[model samples]
Target: MHPPSVRSERLVSPTGRGYLQLESHPAGCFRGVELMRAQVPAPDAPPARRPTALVIGSSAGYGLASTITGLVRYGIDGVGIGWERAAGQRSASAGWYRTIAAATIARDLRSNFVFRNADAFADSTKSETLDLLEERFGGVDYLIYSVAAPRRTDPRTGITHQSVLKPLGEPHTTRNLEFADDGTALLRDVTVEPATEAEKAATVRVMGGEDWSRWVTALAGRGLLRDGFRTVALSYIGSPLTSAIYRAGTIGAAKEHLESTAVTLDALLAGFGGRALVSVNGAVISQALTAVPGIPLYVCLLRGVLGDRFPSPVEQSLQLWEQLTADRPDVDERGRIRLDRWELSAAVQATMAERWRSVTPATLTELADVPWFRTQFRALYGFDVPGVDYAVPVATDLPWPGSPAR
Candidate 1:
């Protein structure tokens, strides 16, 4: 049968300052997934028994990379849960296309991959996922939580919490990257005011470890946690350069709660021969990070300093998998996996700091890889991907191969 076809156009944000692209290219998304799959190295040997993994928020960025690594590198079967919109008059979200591409690729590789397009914060979604785990996979060997939502509704309270990107105490003023309507990257000083007490609490409510803890507790309570089951939540700790607005900011407060929850869950899982951990990942271009005040500038500078040594999201995910599966996982004193070691290296920091200190609007391109940064951001929405002809028409309403029929 002929492949589905629909004329999809490229759409960017009307304001140009916004990070979210209006539409995604299907062919580009598929090619991007293929490229990521190719980066996952094969396991050293076949496993004694096949494992199953479930990746919450697994349609994009680190979550998607982790899902691809689980299936492509370790030969695992898995389920990926993501909240994405279907195509209507415009097009489906980039995540929607990515999940479909991932599922299609997994099937080609003979892996049983399931994709659920629903709000993961809902109790109903949790129950459905649990049923799938019990019926299809028997239980989950790995649980990877990498959610990055701006807001979340509390299933029990029926209240919605929106996360903000502001410092906790005083207002933070920093250099930020802004894009012009003509696609020029400009350096501007942006000041972000401190979040209110209620906002901080709400940020924690939306982005903190509460949901992760809930998910783990629910799984264990349902008798679905297998022996040696491992669960990890993705976190980040950037350099002191962006600390005021990032690592020491409102989001950082939420991450602190998340890390603490890992410690608590670790103790709870010990009885089942399981463990919980938080993996502090490296700085990589992602849709969520693009919206943060100071991260784009920091990441662009870091990329310029690291150059070829910079680790992509997929590369970091592979490293994370290796660390998690090791007999004695390498962790810091706080028992958190350090995937940001390279990005946080003293040499890298020094170089990036020097560049940051000297960088100006005129020298921005010379000091940082702004072009590459822009390309990466565009690629997140399935544009500028290599080996894809965006000029040709492609399908936008592609069905997710792993989703059950209506």
Candidate 2:
């Protein structure tokens, strides 16, 4: 008689469909689930997937998530647009971090991806990008515009405008922000800043869609954009509380311009069946967003309401991909694929407003909780990268991709 055989079985999810697997590491369990849920194939090349495109700012947050969605969810080999060099020697601006992470993820996923690391704001960088496009895939089918910066320099005027977060109207006194050394909890006091007219104007000019228009025009001029090509840029519309710092503030002005720029670009691309859309996304906890006044409290408050329904970067990007690829005849007169309709959902916003009312300095400590704040803050910079050991030394010497165009 044979010795008693040992067997083990574990329930699993593939293609996000339910299955059972025997003997898998606990840490790796999410693999089967994520793969199935996201719908990436094990053998790869199951069906002819949509031709991939180029994504600017494709290293972290929404940009990174979009890149992954292109590969895993859509099975498209994508090129990320980024800036790898700067005037000064400060390594690892947010963009650099994004590019590095994108490269690593692309490699792991066995996707044919390339990082077109250059100053996207500069003509030289743009030329280099064109060269890369010519050599690599001949052309890109989609362009995701997710570039974010605090300043912009006009090549024509030769004037540089540094962006700021000061609110419009009178000297705005808002909460002061002080974070613990351990990056745990934040302490707030009423902070005040007087915005000069020039400061406000500079903020708008830098954040506005003037540059976005230039980019689309440049790409079209090069004849690099394929017919039926599309591009998307992210925008935001916030509430009254945030209006001082976000919506009605300097950033808000810029975002308004950005939205308008989309319409203009759509007209420009209409000839080739190309279009530009502005995605007015919900507020996410990005590195730059954390710097905004009152956003910390806003995030904490929103979290209580959004709960699990508030999508993560990955989910958001997946939705964006679906919007880009799905067969739909619906087009609004505004010429935008309106994700903002869902973003500004009445249920979500109503809940957020209620939560906002309940938050205060005294109650915040207990209501928000320390761990939640820490997690959100750390998540901003890819610090809590899943499956990566946080204790491991991340090299500072890594060449950062800064906006050399700035």
Q: List candidate 1 segments past 4 Å from native.
A: 1-3, 6-17, 403-406
lDDT of candidate 1 over 240-295, digit per residue (tens): 99998787888999999999999999999999888899999999899888888878
Tens digit of lDDT per residue, candidate 2, span 346-369? Answer: 886786677566656566665554
Give the TM-score of each candidate: 0.96, 0.79
**Predicted structure 2, TM vs. truth:** 0.79
Q: After best superposition, candidate 2 residue 324: deviation in angstroms?
A: 1.3
- Cα-based RMSD of the predictions, in order? 2.2, 10.5
Residue pairs with backbone atoms closer than 3 Å in model 2 (clashes): 15-36, 16-36, 16-37, 59-98, 83-118, 84-401, 92-400, 176-189
lDDT score, candidate 2, position 9: 23
